[model samples]
Every structure is written in structure tokens, then in C-alpha cells.
Target: MSLLDEKQRGAILRALHDLRRAAPARPGEQYGAPGNGSSLLLSLVTVGLVFALWYVATNVGWIKPLFLPSPQAVWMQLMDVASDGFADASLLSHIGWSAFRVFGAFVLAACTAIPVGIMMGVNRVARGVLDPLVEFYRPLPPLAYLPLVVIWMGIGEGSKVLLIYLAMFAPLALSARAGVKSVAIEQIHAAYSMGASRGQVLRHVIMPAALPEILTGMRIAIGFGWTTLVAAEMVAATAGLGFMVLTASKFMATDVVIMGILVIGAMALLFDLGMRWLERRLVPWKGKA
Candidate 1:
């Protein structure tokens, strides 16, 4: 009962596919596409230009070495720190310590904050109770409460972890709450019509919808955790990248300071990349309109 022969139908389908392939992605659609290679090349080119400029500026003495050490000097300092150690510990040890504090606090915050945020989104009472507290402290800088944290928890690893934890908690919680609230009412109603229980609805409907936001929150929370690391390590910290950088500054080791900064930046960037990969794996539909 076909209106046309197989060849005509096949030709129409092929044309439709070609049209789709040629179409540009709309805004808030695909996160990446086949053309990503060009974008990556541009990024690499930009980085190369920046480094070239830095090299020229330093070698030409356009900028003082004190303010900005040459990239060569920074690299030499990195090698020295890696092999001979810095601030009474190897570079790896400092990195390990800093990672321990940042990631431990990050994990703790994610575990606690996400659930609280979900509760806040789902229940007015929970929202009422926690909203004021989260809002009150979130705007305060870590330095503002560092002294209080030290006084209460003492200058131990516990205090450092807690400091970073507090920094991350608010953002994660808020993001999760926002994610839950963003879930469409129609989705909930559809789930309910299918005889889904409250628990099932949350598990299947709300959680998936909210996952993208929660993942985004985790990314933000980790950044906050890293930001708080230096403040945390300031409290009686013998070994950490933050401590090393602080110590080096006292001795006016600009190269060491720059090296530490680069190392930290690299680590943070790696974590962000990991988060992005996870987001793609868990919610490939994200960014779609």
C-alpha cells in the first residue's frame, strides 16, 4: 500500500538526513560538535601566543623579573621543587596534602549539601529553616571567619577541612535546591499518573532532571574549596602548596610563588575537565533546549 516506490521513499529519507547533518546547532543545544577540533586548535594557538608574549616581555626586560619571573625561571624552580623539595617537604607531598584537604572537604560537602538542598527544594519547612543560614554565611569571605574557625576547632587538620567544607557547602546546597525547583510540574504530574510513589517520583523523575544542576554545583563547590585552601593551610600548616607559597613569599622567591600558582591552576583545571567528562557521561542531554 505504498504511495511511492522504495527508491523515492529512500531518497526522501536520505535528503532529510542530509538536511539535519548540514544544520547548525541552535543556542543551548549541543555542547560540542564535529567542529570541536577547530575550537581546540584556536585555544592552543591562544596559549602559544600568550607564552610567546610573556617570553618576549621578560627577555626584553619590559617587565621587571621581581614582579613576573621569566617562564624559564618558573620552570627551573618547578624542577628544583620537584627534586630537592620546598618548605621541608617534596613538591609531591605538598600537592598530596593540599589535594587531601581540598578533595576531602569537597566530598564531605557534596554528600551533605546535596541532600539538604533536595529537602529544601521539596519541602517549604526545610527551605525556611536552612535558607537563612546558608544565605547569611555564603557571602562572607573565608578570611572573615578564619579566626572563628581556628578558635573553635583549633589549628589542626580538622579545622582546615571544616573551613574548606563550609566554603563549598552553601553553593552545592543552593544549586541542588535550584535544580529540584527547576523540574517541570508536568513531569511530576505525569509520573504521578503512572502510579509512581513519592519515592519513585523523586528517584526517577526529579533526580534525573536535577542531576545536571547538582553536577554543576559540584564543579562550583570544588572551586570554592580550592579558594579556601590557602586560608585553611594558614592555620599551623607545615606542608601544603599554600604553605609553601606563603613561605616562599617571605623569602621573596618569586619563581617559587609563580610555580606554586601554576601548579594549583593546573590541578584545578584537571578537576574541572574531569567534572565535564562526568557530566557528559551522566547527562549527555544537557545543554539541549
Candidate 2:
């Protein structure tokens, strides 16, 4: 009564078995995985070592005060900014503005890029039309286009958001396109053989299979967007971490510059960690066959 012959069923079972065997031994653990506790400890130790070197260098005059302020001086500057504000705005306000711009651009880029990338992957015409354009812009740095954006959109929020959006768009689109292209042909064939419609196949098979790569792309895009934030905010911006940093550097306020750099690095690290957690939740079989 079964549609699949005995040989077909056996082959399917064997394939499933092999897939399981090829999977990682545990969730979040690949080959030669280290213990989580050990990893955390080692990371903390490395950070401490770097800080110690920084303190010693500043104190011993191995690095000039102008070039690298002491840790104590930087700490005092951070406290001052927290209490008195920087560049006519509080540090928190600057951070808030920066976050708003980055997230706005990132969300817009993700929404448009994912769908367009998926289309490009599935339709040859779409790929032919868009691929050359994406490839051309993808390699150009954000600063290269900043002047044009400012000229067209003005040095307002529109230009800032557009700059970051352009920075994020390419990576997300390319990643999604690559993900779809990487789908197993046999899986598509199997879905079709089961009488699934094109919509059903795309929804249940292609999208799910491609989600991990898409998410990875999103993480990369966010990094690119964040890196472009300084350039974005440098264009007639008054309230942003980038604005604060640029303002401090102009005044030779090394401490403020360092604090801004640290804040940006910390925020980027947190976002990256959050993305990794989301990827694990959404694609539990990411590393599994």
C-alpha cells in the first residue's frame, strides 16, 4: 500500500542515519570543542592582561600621555561625561542616538535585502538584473558614497540612515542569495515529488534551510552598519557616539575618544552575542547535517 518501494524506504532511512551520525556530538559543540567555563576564564584573563599592559605603558611613559591616556584619566573622563555631558548632550543621549540610527538602517536593510536576495536566488531574471549592481556597490566603502548621499539627501538624518543602510544591504542580500543557492537539489526534488506546490516548497523547505545563512548575513551586515556609523554621524550630526568621538578628537580629548571607542566595541560585542543566541534558537540544526 505504501508509495515508496522497500529499497526507497531503506535508502531514506540510511540517509537519515548518516545525517544524524554526521551531526555534532552536542548542541553548540563542534569538533574539539572546549568547555564553556574554560573559554570564559581564558577570555577574562586575556582582557585583564591587555588592560595591565595599557596601564603600565601609560604610567611608565612608554606611551606618551597625549597618545595614550592613563586608565585613571580615562575613567575620570568617563565619569565626567556621565555627569556633565559631552558635546552639549549626555553620554547616554549620544549612545541612544547612535543606537537608533544603526537599528533603523539595519531593520530597513534586512527587510528589503532578504526578500530581494531570495528572489534573486529563485529567479534567474532577478539575479541577472541585480547581481551586477550588487557586486559593483558591494566592494565600495561607505565613505566613498557618503558625499553623494549627503549631496542628494542632505546632511540630515536621511543621509545618515541611508549611508548605514547601504553599508548593510550588500552583505545581507548576498548571504541570503548564497544560502538559497546552497540548498540541496535532492531536497527540492523530494519536496516536489510529494506534490507540494512551489509556495509550499519555498516556505517549508527553502526558507527554513536557508535561514541560518540569512541570519549569519544579518550579523555581518550589522557589523558593517555599526562600523559605518562614525562616517554617517560625522556629517552634520549633533547627538551620537560618533559625533561625540569626532568632537573629542578635534579638541584632542583622547580620554573621551577612548571611552567612545570602548562603548562602541562593547555594544557591538553584545549585539553579536545576541545574534548568536538567536541563531541557535532559530536553527538548532545549523551545524548538523
User: Relative to the true structure, how large is the alpha-carbon lDDT of every model?
Assistant: 0.88, 0.89
The RMSD of every model to the true structure, in order and in angstroms, is 8.4, 4.4
Model 1 spans with C-alpha error above 4 angstroms: 1-34
lDDT of 1 by residue, 1-289 (tens): 2544344435533543454356566443365444657878988999999999999999899999898999999999999999999977999999999999999999899999999999999999999999999999999999999999999999889999999999999999999999999987876776566555687678767888899999999999999988888889999999998998889999989999989988998999999999999998987666654
The candidate 2 region of ten consecutive residues with least summed lDDT is 1-10
List the candidates' TM-scores in order.
Answer: 0.89, 0.90
- lDDT for model 1, please: 0.88
Q: Show where candidate 2 strays beyond 4 Å.
A: 1-31
Poorest lDDT segment (10 consecutive residues) of candidate 1:
11-20
* Reference-based TM-score, model 2: 0.90
Which candidate should be chosen as best, given lDDT against the real structure? 2
